[model samples]
Target: MVEKNTTKTYIKEWQKAIQKEISFLKKFGGTRYIVYNGRFISRDEMFTYYFDTSSSLPIPIGSKIRLEWGGLKTNGRVLSSEGKGMIVALEKSIGELISEATLLHDPWELLENLIERLDEIKKSKQKRARLKRLMDPTMEPKHPTTRIKSNVHELTLRSKYNPVTFVWGPPGTGKTYTLARVAANKYLQEKRILVLAHSNQAVDVLLAEISLFLKRKDKFCVGDVLRYGTNSGQSLANHTEITSEQLIESSNPKLSKERTALLVERRTIKQDLTRSFSKRDSDELLEIETKLARLLDKFRQKELELLKKAAIIGTTLAKAASDSAIYEKEFDLIIVDEASMAYVPQAAFAATLGKRVIICGDFKQLPPIAASRDLLVTEWLKEDIFHKTNVADSVNQQKLHPHMLLLKEQRRMHPDISAFTNQYIYKSLVADHEAVYTNRNKIVLQTPFSGHASILLDTSYTGHHSLSEKSSNSRYNLWQLLLSFQLIYESVLGGAKSIGYVTPYRIQSNLMNLLIEELLENENKNADIIAATVHRFQGSERDVMIFDTVDAEPQSRPGMLLVGKDSERLINVAITRTRGKFIHVSNTSFIKKNIFRGKTLRQLVDHQMQHNQQVTTQKIGYWIKNQHSKLAWSHARKQSKVFQDLQSAKNSIVIAIPEGKTLATEWERMLAKRHPKVSFTLVSKQPMQHLQPNQWMDENIAFPFILIDEEILWLGQPLEAVVDVDPPFVAARLHSRKVSEFFIGQLLKE
Candidate 1:
């Protein structure tokens, strides 16, 4: 029997973690908005609230929102987004309170479910033992384990004997593909299975794979698999027949007819209420709302019945936990794909609903994006199942767990590209599948820098300075953005089919998106390209991956991209996402200075340098200039060229520096003395004591750059470099009025 004290400690820890999450949400205003106007729609049987569109975060369609007005609050789920309005299905009618309502974060219903599940575990001996085994990695399984097998799929199939099994999959290891096969096999055995993932996209992807597998085996039926949520991927539209809502409507004509009739009545009543809000109309509206609620309850009952009969069910973790009907239902087996992105509590909650649980994910990838930094919360909530159970430690230490299976063969990246991750991240545990070395997967970009599978574009000569936004913690680097665009543009021209631009910051990703759009517009080329953060790029691969490390400010330490507990994992994901070529765009000088904090990044750079895979700024500039002479050029060795370019400015000059106000003041004086008529504005993050407010703007600029005459854009080496002895600085010049105007607008934004 488990000790009572230990169980109590677990309960307390879970409670503290949940509270910390709630506290953080309250403090940071997690997905909230205040309604300016609201009204009940009888036709749709839902409430519509119009709010300002200037929210810090967008409220997703399926998010549960809490409405508060006049000291009363009610809960509802967002049905859809309509213009500047949100359509929500509230639990109860607020009548006139709708207009004065404030939409708050989702209700803490999941927290209650988690706590209740903990209490149930505390009361049941079987549950306690299962939880103990899942949480305590040292606890040996009561059942004898099967012998290790070379085939990971076969090993996963045999995992039914163990109470819990972990699939330690690294990048490109086909983690979801393996999980789908195991789930399909279990379904064939007549065992009801629950498939869960961290995101709706992941859940849909896995369900689609399982559907295909079952169809290939000739055991698939119309109602064999059911997708439980509404936010399904467009690709899953092919299997719309398997959705719970669709299945219920088709199978049971009586309930479907009733729902249709209720919806029609609701529409009629809503039309009447729109004309008048009299007491009688309000009463009629409330009556219709009651009828619709009863109808929805019936639909839920039917859905539960359908869920019990289905061979497999797929939904996100949040959906599975928040929905009471799904939470009450149990399954014979539960498989969580992308389990590393799920919190420990979420995985544990999934564990309670199944007789056996299998978690498939790479713990070396991203973890749950938690807002709280409380030690207890980070220890209990931020950690995924692998870390919580010490499985990650065992895998890293080369100690194999009896119930854990590791998929070492990866079919995604080329041997040359995978070598770095294999040595530095995985400790040589991962191997390339034979198919990866074939001619089909060879790196063959048509660009000059295409021979090697990997290239580290060292931006040290250009001084890769990054800026943090004043409103948010996101950072952006202009030089990296421009260089990445050139590389991507050249690769697209070289016949690259697919490309993925991965960055560590949202601002930088946004900049990349703009550049890609321009490339498509100007070049009129058709190519598959996606720019996003590393978290969004997980579970995806591409022909050429551009990993932009957008943190290189000299004054500040490396950002979370290179100085967090998960830094190595982030780097590993970024590097391993490439199938043919991997480009690491970073400032080597900044990384070397902060080597202790950014050890993983420094190690990656060192590996590339040792292999002579370093691409210089001069080469990039020369290549771009050769392709489009008027577009861009680099001047690394000559400070005279930068000043010479600056001297050509006739209209205005805006110099933005993060620090060094003294140096900036001297440079501004010299520039103003030289060009007396040109407007000179020195922008810095701190107030300049020597300049007027009009001449100096206090803003949180990340890097130093000079916008000359709103036509010539000078990036690299602050204006201070002109006066002081020039270090190994590289300045880039872009002659694009559109690009210059875009930067000027961003810098001058209120």
Candidate 2:
């Protein structure tokens, strides 16, 4: 459950913040008003104004506007424009303003009051009936597991029945694809569905996939699909389907002239609707409402038809909340794609229009752009419904609700790269066998030197930050920049069609772009190389990915490395973007100190080092423990044979002990007593000599072994006494017979 505030302190601060914002906006206005058509509008502060059907200025509705009149400069947002006039909201703040739908204003009281109402409803008789219907245990998943994975089937089925079903879609697991499939399938069953995403681009992606799926199956015609909003035409321009814009174009032929006149009329249609709604004249309201309905019926029939046809409705969550046509409409199911990136209130508001809700996104990936950390009074603002509902404590304590699902099969990234993330992040992430056994996951790097698919280029630069003189947000390292160029050159020479360069800092990315631009200008050449920040390149991938970790200098500000999950998510996205090769460039010394940012790089370094021949005591101990169970039988047989030889020896067995060491322990004496013919010899380095007496023949040779009856040579770390120990205590595996024989031959020569 959520914590609620008992006092009005938070409410006051929230109100103060809003007032401060309005004050800040007022500062953007000047003391001048622009006159158009003998009418005056205040321009005292910067306000945005959009013209209606006029060829004055082609300022886009959403573009940031700065007004300059009478040597006074101010800024604001364009509220509305029509009939050779424009309505401008003075003193607009470009910064993220807390949307009215958000619960930041007295959230605690709102939530608490909501909970109290819910509790009262729970005690009512009608509530009991509703709960009984919802809690039907006989309800099972509708889809067959044979056709789809059980988990996915359960998710699709629960999402259809439950009011809200949260889906934990990790990276590369086809969150969009799965949801689209479900949407398409549900559509065929005559269920009206609305699919929403955080961005218009995300909506387009879902529409494209759903359209493709339905088309492939011959389930629905392409004309049944509809897209909405500004530039809806361009976004769906490639598709041979019906859209809202197309509907508007297809009007009654008898009124064609009237329609044309209406299109070019110097009046604003938006303002007409606003004025009509605001007026209290019943007859006028009826007339205006009837006209709007008729107009919308003529133009929005295809969109209306698509919604009725149960084909699919695609829109951004924000659009779904704001659009008058959809705000009042109810749907059988609402699927939210990339739900983790949407504000909780926005999604909740969208869910209100639907009977069932399905939220799909990975909380571990990039979330919504948080405007201000201070304004976000609760963590709920930053998380989607999926994350907020699935608390770790509830799951750990076995008190989890069973409606959620996780997509575990990662279809992207090489096994090497995916393996790191799987171990580092996922609870149970399985790499597809295709990525392991097939060549698809193998990265193709064409560097001059043969290196691993994932390679770390050590710049050796430490704690030096170079802030850009041109851009304030960027930082770059000369060493890293030079390395990036070399790698890019190599990649281009190696016949790579495209290469993506990503830097953690905007400054470094800017510097890299500048370098690329200058190089292109000088050489008069163009290449398919795109440089972007990690956040910008979220949904994109490249043939070869070159990531520049730009924070080689001491971090004065709390950077990606320090932020809890943001760093992990960013690094994961950066490294996994490469399809063929993942090239990481960073300073090792600087990165080792970071907990999250350089984790992938450090893992790669450790992996590379393991392949080298240099051995350590820990490495030796690990080897011995692993091989003990397999080679124990053979070693035991060898020991038995050595004991028999000592027992049967007629001559004394001369055993050499190293200097300053002894075999006078009880176990050693017992072994000596068992074999009375064995004798011990001390191998010592003589005074003023650099070599031991035993190694006088060869100064390069040193033996740390024990000889029994002068026949058996046990090659390992020698202890003070000869006693059998476990494998961990043993320093090395037994040496080869050839090496032992060569040593013995050298001893005889000495």
Candidate 3:
């Protein structure tokens, strides 16, 4: 007898229904799907039911499930008969299971029963819909599985619109671990599931998940399969790193890039409805795209001259395949993680390879390409020409199919910090679970805090001869400032704090070498100093954050950081890196040296200058954390100290420093010595003139070319601090880097 419950489906039309006679695999290959109310799954409900290594039954797809504390497993449809067939097929024989089986009243039996009932209903509907929509465009997916929530009476509010779902679980939210069963259900049912991640470490974690899931499938471990986008993604491989240029290119060549392009085209058109791409300079880019589209038509028709003439547009979508006729490789699903910092074009370029996609991200963290003055914008042509004039239609943009949804609940930072972030960050979110205010589910990343943080404008120097001189000459006087802060914090703490050094480019990596060598590598000083790209820290757990905006371009604020757009799923990954304590160090001391030339950063710097002019010192307060960076922002401004989050931030702090003189000095020295033999020639072909600060170049400055071994070096003073333009042959123009003694000879004032 079916237990009568109030649970029912809300959006009558189920985009994906469970398949008949097939065991649910991963998101890609589940035999079928079941539709039910999803709104019932609260932010806290998805994890109420827990399946461990010991649970004889793996979490099935489209199953009515729930998890509760204590060993009392309360479930509805315990999957007694159909599950038997799946287990017999994937793991063991039906004979062995029946012979040894003694069905007990396991509390989870209820959940299994409920799932069967739901599956049975789905099966009946499938039988009808399959025949009704034989060639129907609306019923296109062969077998799409609706997301299942383990809490509440139903799992309704699932996302299937773009066929790509994104869940940004911060720190200990089990981001990687939770996908195990979800992935397995899709695979068992039969689907090609691709895991797209930015780093090898993340892929490794997912590999561990696959192993654990298979180990429990006593019967079906044979057909269980998994694959990564890279060699380092293999759980057992020990391969070396591939060059960044090579790694990003030809990655699954036709497959991945095609999928990304499709996603890019769709998302751009969708967003264009609300925001004007022209206002963002993306509209003018269309003029270039139209010319290329016509050229492409000529090229596709075997016109060689068109190819030579279309270099400009091809630069935007290098091999971007917009036509569906060329891209037909269909997949069950594509899962993308860490997407925020991803440039929009790169993400869209990779989506054409997948049939289905899921995206996840947190926008409030750090955005893509470091917060600079203004932002970069790019959009592709909409196959449909009718919507060109009135592209800002909100209805079309909001028409995210039932499955294409956003997740709002944030399980990463502490409530103390999340409040400050959400309040300051996502004023408007796209999903229900995108932001939650509680500490019940997050990891315990609590660090002690007492108001001791303060920014010290240090004035010292410690580096090699050339680097040391540059450090001394820097506008910020960073080395001397760093030493001063180190001395003060060392005296009180007696050891180094958990400090991190972040630079926008590899050139910045040189500066951290000395500090890291003296402490971490040498192990001479008792402290912790980590050097990493800001990209790697996304979705990580950290106590203190110190931003080195010293030479960084200025900016206003960021809305999101898209690192990758898997398939059609927009998974923003970078901006959600820090748990507490954010510090920014920019070369604001001399506004002219600021690398970024945009509206956002100018506003920030100008506002701060205005702020300092109004606020007096005696009323000011301060806080401290690591030995590097300035006095925490909480103490520098009275208005900021009122936040309750700051009350718990004694141990966590934000250090802000506008650029100064000394920091640049040491960096220049380091740059000159790194290429002691490098030489540069004037791009204008003019005789050497006075090398003054403002008159170093004429119009469209260019320089000589040389290599610093295999390492690619980006020069400063004009192209950086928020403006990202790194083309190998072109960078030499304004930002030159050559391995020759000629240029260094002239640059060396000594």
For lDDT, the strongest prediction is: 1
lDDT digits (tens) for residues 12-63 of candidate 1: 6887788887777665545557665465654355554333223323566566
Report the poorest 10 consecutive residues by lDDT, candidate 1: 48-57
lDDT of 2: 0.51
| TM-score of predicted structure 1 | 0.80
What is the lDDT ranking, best to worst? 1, 2, 3
Per-model TM against the reference: 0.80, 0.59, 0.38
* RMSD in Å for model 2: 23.4
**Model 3 — TM-score against the truth?**
0.38
Residue 467, candidate 2: Cα error in Å is 3.9
Order of candidate numbers by TM-score, starting with the best: 1, 2, 3
lDDT of each: 0.73, 0.51, 0.31
- Cα lDDT tens digits for candidate 2, 1-750: 433321122233333433433333344422223423211223445532322323233333333344443344444444433334344444643222211110011112222332333343334554333223222212343434455555546777767656556677666777777887888878877877888887777787778778778778877664456666543344465653545554445534544455455444324444453344222322232333345446655655545554555347787765665555665576878887877777554555555556777777776666665333445433645555555444322434434445556677776665655666676655344454375434533245354223345656654422133333232435555436645765676666555666788877766676567656644343224347888788777766676788777655434433543244566677777876766677777655555665344455455445434534222222322222122210121232234444454466444343444434344343243345444434543343422132112233222212334444344444332434223233333322222333334334444553
